[model samples]
Target: MQTEKIVNHIVSWLNNYATNAKVNGFVVGISGGIDSAVTSTLCAKTGLDVLCVEMPIHQAESHVSRGQEHIQFLKETYPNVRATIANLTPVFEAFKKEVLMEGKQDIVDMVLANTRARLRMTTLYYYAGLEKLLVAGTGNKVEDFGVGFYTKYGDGGVDLSPIADLMKSEVYALGEYLNVAKSIMKAAPSDGLFGDTRSDEDQIGASYPELEWAMMMNDAGKQETDFEGRNQEVFKIFKRFNNANKHKMNPIPICEIPNKFK
Candidate 1:
C-alpha cells in the first residue's frame, strides 16, 4: 500500500474507533524503537488527544534519551499530543528481589525480561485509565504473528493495533513517509526488555525480512525440497519461533466436551 494512503486510513480508523468507543484518545508507550515511533505518529496524526508515555526500567541512557526526543518531536509536531516519563526501575528492582527472586525456584533471564514488559504494560494502562483512552499497540506483523517475539498480555494486550498488519520493512517505509526522527529510523530494532543493548536480530537469529519470507512460505504450505531449496535456514528459524510461540498466537484454549459426554 502507498504509505500516505495507509497513514490516512490508520488515522481515520483511530478516530472512528475512538468515536464509537466513546474514549478520549490514544495511549502509546514509546520504547525508542521505529515501531513505537511509527505507531505514536499515526495516533498523533488523528489530531485526537494522544499520550506518548516513556516508561524506562533500568534502560540505557541513550534509549531513554531517544524516547524523550521522540516525545518532544511529537509534542512539537502535533498540538494534541502529550507526553510523560515514568521510571519503573525502582519498582522493577523491588519486585524482582522481594518477589520473583525470593522463591527457591530459580527464575530465568527471560522471566525478568517479561516482568519488565508487564511493568511497562501496567504503566500504560494507568495513564490510559486516568485519561479514559485506549492503549495503542506498536507490534508489527513479523513479531506479532510470524515470530511471536512480544510478551503476551504485556505488549500483546492492547485496545487497538494500528501497525500489526504491516511488516517490519513496511513500518520503516511508513516511518519515512511520516518523517519520523532519523535517529529512530536508523536505530536497530530492540524490545528494550533485555538489560543489554542487543538488537532484535541478535536475539531472533534472523533479520525481520528473512522472518517475513519464512512466514509467507509457511502460510503457503511450502517447504524445502533439498539443498536446492531456498532459504532453508530462514524456514527453520521461522518454524522454531512459530512452534515455540504458537500458543501465544492463538486464543486461549478451553476444554470442549463431546456430545456424548455432555
Candidate 2:
C-alpha cells in the first residue's frame, strides 16, 4: 500500500485542507483505538495545532490508559500537538438522570451507548469551535462505509476524514509506520462506547479481515447464494449491517417541494 507515500499524502492533504478552510488546526477525540491513534498522528505530522481530546464516560481502564499513552506520545514527539481531558462522566450521569429510561433493557442500553458517542462528539466540536480547529474524524473504510459501525451525528459527525479511504488493515499499517504506542496497536479493536471489554468483532459477529473480504465480495457483485457454510454466514452478517445502516452511509434525505407549488 506504499505506507510511507500514503502517510505523506494524508499529511499534505490535511495541511492543505486546513489552510484552505482557514482553520488553525484539528481537534480529534482520542479513544485509545487504532483509528484514532493513526489519525491523530497524521494530523500531528502536518505540524499544525493538533489537539487530542480525551472524553471518557464510564470508559474501561485499558481504553483510558491507551488514550493517555497515545496522547503523551504525541506531545513528546510533536511540538505542535497538545491534549486535554474533558472527563465527561459527570455530564453523562447528569444527562441520564434527566432522560427517560423506560424501554426494553437492550434497547435502553443501545440508546445510552450511542449517547456516549454523541456526548463525545459534542465535546470535540466544542473544542474545535473554541480553538478554531476542524474536527478530524477517526473512521476507516470498513467502519465508515462497509458496516456503519459508528454513531450517526456522533462519531460520524466530522469536518474531515483523513483515513476513511483506508481499510482497517491499512490503518494498522499506518499505525505501525507512525510508531503508535504498542499497547494501542496490540489492543482488540473496539468502539469503546459500551464501556466494556467486548471487541468490535463481538459486536459485529465478524472480524475486520472477514468483513473486509465480505465488503470486497459485495463490491464485486457477489451474492449470498455463491458462498457456503462460514463464508455464507459472514456474507450475511456483512449484508445485514450494510443494509440496516444504509441511513448512516447515505446522504440525509430531504423532501423536495414542487416548483409549481412554490
Tell me the spans in candidate 2 whose CA falls farther than 4 Å from its real position.
none
Q: Report the C-alpha lDDT of model 2 over 1-262, residue by residue, as the tens digit.
A: 8999999999999999999999999999999999999999999999999999999989999999999999999999999999999989999999999999998999999999999999999999999999999999999999999999999999999999999999999999999999999999899999998888889999999999999999999999999999999999999999999999999999999999999999
lDDT of 1 by residue, 41-121 (tens): 999998889999888888977788788888998899999999888989999988877764543442567788898999889
Candidate 2: lDDT of 58? 91
> What's the lDDT of the predicted structure labeled candidate 1?
0.89
Clashes of each: 0, 0
Model 2 residue 88 distance off true place after TM-score fit, in angstroms: 0.6
